[model samples]
Target chain A: MPAANGNNAGILKSGHDARLLSRSNKCGNTSGLAPGYVQTNLIVLPSRYASDFRLLCARNTVPCPLVAESATPGHWGKIKSHLLGIDGETLAKGLDIRRDAPKYNVYVDGKLHRQDCEDIVTEWTDDHVAFLIGCSFSFETALADAGLTPTHTARGRNVPMYRTTLPLCAAGVFRDSTYVVSMRSYPASEVERVRDITRPFASTHGEPVAWGWDALERLGIRDIDSPQWGDAPLAKIDGKPLSSFKNNEAEVPVFWGCGVTPQEAVMRANLEGVVMAHSPGHMILLDTLDVETIRKF
Target chain B: MPAANGNNAGILKSGHDARLLSRSNKCGNTSGLAPGYVQTNLIVLPSRYASDFRLLCARNTVPCPLVAESATPGHWGKIKSHLLGIDGETLAKGLDIRRDAPKYNVYVDGKLHRQDCEDIVTEWTDDHVAFLIGCSFSFETALADAGLTPTHTARGRNVPMYRTTLPLCAAGVFRDSTYVVSMRSYPASEVERVRDITRPFASTHGEPVAWGWDALERLGIRDIDSPQWGDAPLAKIDGKPLSSFKNNEAEVPVFWGCGVTPQEAVMRANLEGVVMAHSPGHMILLDTLDVETIRKF
Candidate 1:
């Protein structure tokens, strides 16, 4: 049996076990919790917009690589290799999706309505479809194992994300949106190796799409310290923005397609419907191995 | 300009030109016509069944790798780089999808209403959505260029396809269907080379799923000479069913996911709504190259 710590008793020793730890400890971040297992971004939309959302993910594969999805409107456990359901070998008995995650963000008519909640069982409906998107957390373990921990991870801060000038390929009613990218600065010399390490994780945004400070200007980033979501870099010497660390001389910021892009697109589309997502940094841990998640079918 | 041997004029010297050639010559097989351009399988379903079909394609990507789709109901050429309308450069001034293909197969309520027809204009409705699935014809050119021509192409016969025991992952009302695979035979020594050559064209069912005579038994294939669709192998020596060839001493049978699979599933589902598809050897030729078709976002 895999070792379990914190509140976890039956689950594998992973970021998932740590997430259970966070839930009991009143901590919200699920990032860096499950190491080898896949972590997924969550988005629940009404069945009316499900097809369009599916099309959106297919068109924008890099930013929105679908991991598993609800087979029917009301079905949650139908994901073939799920972690939190009864049909497959589940993490817990009698699992309820609405109450499982560390935190939830509720949106009404595409506007942020609730910031953080322990559970959203009252908000969910029978006509809702849940989508699981592979998250950057799935690939961070590989990067760390290769001795290239992301700068944000090393500094104990959430990864910085920015909206880019790159427009997404439109699908159906989902339209008029730009890609959102997460940034992690690395030594300029190690950029190629960093790309190589992350290249196989295509389901997790694959390799960095842009590199260096020039990329910041190209992607229209005015400041590196202030992100659209998540905590800022650790060091801000005398009110001046630096990299994630205090001494950031050799680092160059690299950008990867962010999981927040679909939510951003949903908010921009402004559809007259409710969409729910996991709070930023709070993701759903899955049973699938990271290698299995990236395998070509 | 590329050479145009058959009745092709004004069109670029590629699949588009051959489709024009087939249009005039009343020819159905587009097996060896265009060398570099992409060829696609066609399936048109009512908008009511469109979402389920899209999900089906997503779940069973190997057999139903979607190349392009109608932007909306009743639209034909909204694909970003299409070959059938005015928005982008198209084949003819006013291309009608109903009358374009060399032959059409009309299925009414999951029953074959017509085997072959020059045009499907009489059966078309405004609510239909057209789907273009990438076909193996897109990658055969590369195999030939690598000096590993498939036996079906060498003998000028339509590729033999079989219904396999491999059950497709179900989605929505589309259920209870098995995978359809097309077979080609080559020397045992060249299987790896063949796999290498076709691996890049993932949209067109990259690489064989099974190989050798044992694969036939594993897939529950009782007969190799008699197939569900397309012409039988060119020769059957001594009335013995050979491996897509006569002398089977060194030949090894290789199976690829067939584009005809979605149609098989539709037929099995026994959907009340009629679905339309191109006749087996008559495909829709697109303007995009095989390389462009396989490119990731």
Candidate 2:
């Protein structure tokens, strides 16, 4: 049982438990809320963009894995998911997506319209579709269990994210979107063990795509000290090839496909519709489907 | 030593060994010619499209892993490669790109201009950049050693390829590009073994992206009986959901990122520039690099 400290109950037993927590603590991060379930990043958009958005997840499976998507437009309550061959685990039948998540960030024409909304029930319409993307938090426990806890989590900070030179496979209207990767630094010796632990968790951004100092330069990331989102890694890089990091030169940076990749895509596309996403670190946890079952092998 | 049957030295000691054979046996497929070497797909285009094409490879790393790339506009001969951090293992010095490949397919304005050309010397220009992409053949020996030989290879046929509905992350001027996948069928029980063996070979198209019947519908591949290129798999299908196969229904379909993906992208982009590629199954093999050294882990 996870610490449902703010929950009416002492611990979370299911996805609804986290949603119940969300109702009271509307702006809290869902990082450690649900212990044995799926936590997902949310993207609710107009039906017209749904097809293209769905295609985006299909092509870029690592960054935008589909956990539970509405079978049709406006079926937010029943985001039926049958991913990686799990028999259609419906998320708490009639689990209204608009009010279930902890926080919402609404966008209009690709720019940030509003942030920290408790529920977007007023924003719901028959024309809008909701997509539930697998979140990296779902696999953090697995890493921690394997004694490979991420540096950010150990430091009690959000994982740093950077916009990469790598482009997302563009779907209809979602053109020219650069990939955003979340960064975590590990000891050089622990990097391979970290990758091996997370590779099977395909539902989440499975494995680190880039590692070490050279990879940042390769991915076109100009700086290691500054990041696009969250807290930066504890590193004092000098120049082109990162040789010095804090006092430990053995600290290597690892990057994984980020769920924010979709948000960045929607931001760039700037589509003419209300796009709703979860505030960073705030996510919707689903019941029945444990992260353990979401294996590639 | 691989069968450099037409080689003056009768064995392949370096990447140039295959090029020597390419000069005389201009139309032979380089599949089994250079064992223990990296075999690559060729893509030569005007320098203007090189940046976007590079981005395409960076974004879609699985389908288009970068083994070696032309650093400048016309450094085709000295294709300096430092991929996966091998400390710049340059291929055979002055290995002329124009006349080395076994066969070339030149496209003008995205239409097939010529086929089965011995050399593309006339097509070379100061503005052309040659991109050498990692090919799946670089790992076929690994698969074969693991006893997971692809059905097509065992039957002496080219691997079947299909244009998937999944779109490529569109780069500049390369809009609305769909992904193309190469298919191989295997016994259902051996699928996991196949994935484990190939997952580390990141230089080549690494693991199977999709497998089983459901994956076809998910990728929007309608017909399994007919493929866009190469020979169709040993399959028998009737409708939407594929359940039946050639007697042994235990045979499951496995798909990897095809080198043909770039060709499909170039074909769809239909740019106003000359484009060149190796014919299917024909590739350039490089020395000093083995498929084993190109591990992700």
Instruction: Identify the candidate with maximal lDDT.
Output: 2
B17-130 per-residue lDDT for model 2 (tens digits): 787778665437775566667888888989888766776775576687767767677776767574745533455555667777888899998889999787888888889988
**In model 1, where do residues sit more than 4 Å from their true spots?**
A1-297, B1-12, B21-25, B80-95, B234-249
Instruction: Show the lowest summed lDDT stretch of 10 residues, model 1 chain A.
Output: A1-10
**C-alpha local distance difference test of each model:** 0.69, 0.72
lDDT value, candidate 2, whole model: 0.72
Stretch of 10 with least lDDT, candidate 1 chain B: B1-10
Clashing pairs in 2: A168-B169, A169-B169, A170-B169
Clash tally, candidates in order: 2, 3
Clashing pairs in 1: A15-A33, A15-A34
Query: Could you list the iRMS of every candidate?
Result: 15.3, 14.4
- lDDT of candidate 1 at residue B157, scale 0 to 100: 66
Evaluated against the true structure, the overall lDDT of model 1 is 0.69
Off by over 4 Å in 2: A1-11, A25-27, A87-89, A235-249, B1-297
Error of 1 at B42 (Å): 0.9
When candidate 2 is compared with the true two-chain complex, its DockQ is 0.03
